[model samples]
Target: MKQHHVWTWPIAGYLFLGGLGAGMSIVCAVADLFFGKGELLGLAPLGALLCLCLGSGLLIFELGRPLQFWRVFSTQRAVLTFGAWMVILLVVFDALYFSFFSGWFPWSAAAGARAVVAVIALLLGLGVLLYTGIELSSMKARVLWNTPALPVLFALSGILTGVAGDYLVCGLWPYGGPAADAEALAGILRPLMAGLAVATVVSLLLYVLMMYTSSNPTGRTAATRWLRGSYALPFWLGAVAAGLVLPLLLLILGGMAAALGALLFIVGGVFLRFLTVYSDDRRELAGERERLLKLPHGDEPFLKSNWG
Candidate 1:
């Protein structure tokens, strides 16, 4: 079979930015709604709302036509179903985006709307993870993506990548409220970093475990792009060493070490996306082509390649 590489850069950006927006939105929601942290007042949840909206917008437009995106909600079923949840999230995200950009936020009445949307966005933000999980799970053709663990893996990857994206944005975040205080921001950042690092490791283990349990060629297929020399350098030295191993050790240390660890965690998360999409076997894609051109789905007989 001919092995080939396909780039998923735009979708990668969508996945990365969407996850980050959703993650940040959830964090802000938890901070604002439950703990009653007023520091979340201005741009905190707003930023998350905008980012998610922007990312989701990109995704809708990222498709063949932006209008076709509405096909997700044109259903006759009840609204609480998975499709409903998706549609709801899209609407809620859109509202948040429109309201903020239109300068509706500072008004006294906007507070109530913000409160409601924040809670709903939090729930849907979590759904973002499941949405991604279902995306891969629904695709039966790509066996590697067919595992029951795929949804969970995608969820963790989303959260991990999202948090990492948040940290990377720290370079741009202007100081204010909790973020203004260096020590306090460091404190908040450390725990988040540690949590994400732990999550990333767990995700890796689950992936391997899923593969180990599978006897089918579908489950056992390899995406060697990550294991090869060209990709291996950044993936291993940068993503693994700098992102996981080094940050983990520093997290063990404390102080500036913890902060540094957070940076590495973000770096690691970004590359994890790179590795996942690039290393794709897509379940022996040539086989799919053959099935399209030669054999039927259940047919076993096949023609030999001319190269052989």
Candidate 2:
């Protein structure tokens, strides 16, 4: 079957920004309790809000019409319904929690209320993070997205990005005050970055391997696209090399390198989502492609729409 209405750049932008927001929400919560008092506690929630708004806005933009956007909420499709609701809940929870941190609410001084809001926001944040992957993987039309590893891979990537974001905010913004506070935060973040980087690389490899070996020919095609097709350059250079490798190397050097590493990691994160959207848009059933290859007619159509 011919492909139409393919996912494009908007989808990629949504996935990247939404994943960053979700990851940041959780990181903010952890920083709130762990550090007790720091710039991150305030920055994380604010950053999350900005990311979520921009990400969600892109989703609406992808719908291509204002009137049709509301249908996303009423849709019977599990992916749409679940993702929309999760984003909604995340926004509500994070908004209230951040309001408390911002001291806009008089009851913000109450530890019990803060604790409850923070916990709920963190859970919703996680839901938002995982939903992005689940939504993509649920697309039966794309063999590459059907794997169970996609959700896990996205989650690990989100965690890595979230930590990187925190490191950047704390290092550059320095709300905690004094060089010593930054040093203390760095001590905590350095090893954490190392661990997350390792996990992200492993998950990425597993995702590629699983998709490559999938029984479906379409699945294999999807894998090939990522591995060696038109997407090869962006996948290798943008996502793998710049996104993963360089960040890990810089992070190992410690100090300001962490900020540089985080920035590079964020770039990688964006490119990774771009790879996902563009790669799947090119996916075609492998069996169908083989049949089309045997056509007695001109090879122009076959070559023009080559599955690979």
Candidate 3:
């Protein structure tokens, strides 16, 4: 019956950054393979590599003993261990992919090797994305996070945010690409981002609906909190309106509106991760509340008397 915090901003930051990094890697790989936009000069891949590295750092920092992070590789059965390896491999491959684009070494000129590296990095990136959601959903005690919808929702949001990030980097950074190339990339990415935004909206709605109607009372309570309780303002305004709807409208408007929308999308993605982390309410067992209430308060006279 003892109250304990589920998770905090550090965990949320790891989740958000992990997903965003994975998403950027995916976009980078796809662009090279399909659109022939290798002219991006490896900025996207480098950004993704940094994001994953930073996210991994946050996870390690959250551990009780941060110095023993290498112990994560000591076991293969644990989900966290698997995730750790996934991140390591993704980072390695992503770095290689970036080196190819950046021409960091003489071997970087090999197109076949670069393509292979990109594909591997892309797959590993996806695994990292799924792992972020699965890490939470596997905890059955938190009914709000136990559903399959969570991974799907997380994946969609990750990709959306990743595209937004790519757009922003290409727009703001001088080294991103030539002006004409950036414009062309934006033209291609605009419609893709809008579609992803729509899909994310649908996925989010479905997730909330599933939680609200779940047989588990805890799940319903969590959903209710987001719908009409203390979390409603952020859920409705931050996540839904500014994060999703407004972004969709801006994408439609194009030009400066599109850039602003991308920024909002990134903000909204962060908001979603934080809100989800904070909203994890555990399921209550029968008679647990009553038993806790019957226990003496910390400030009770008997406890204060120091009769020991």
What's the residue-level lDDT of 238 in candidate 2?
86
TM-score of each: 0.69, 0.85, 0.91
Which model is ahead, 1 or 3, in terms of lDDT? 3
> Model 3 over residues 51-143: C-alpha lDDT tens digits?
889988888888889998899999678778888899889988888887887666899789999888888987998898899889888988888
Q: lDDT of all the models against the reference?
A: 0.58, 0.78, 0.85
Query: Quick one: best TM-score, which candidate?
Result: 3
How many clashes show up per model? 0, 0, 0
Q: Kindly indicate the candidate among 2 and 3 with the higher lDDT.
A: 3
Residue ranges of candidate 2 with Cα displaced over 4 Å: 1-5, 34-39, 75-77, 171-178, 281-308
The lDDT leader among the candidates is 3
Q: What is the lDDT of residue 178 in candidate 1?
A: 48
* Cα error, candidate 2, residue 21 (Å): 0.3
lDDT of 2 by residue, 137-190 (tens): 887767677668888888888878888887777634425357676678767877
- Report the Cα RMSD per candidate: 7.0, 5.0, 3.1
Which sequence of candidate numbers ranks them by TM-score, best first? 3, 2, 1
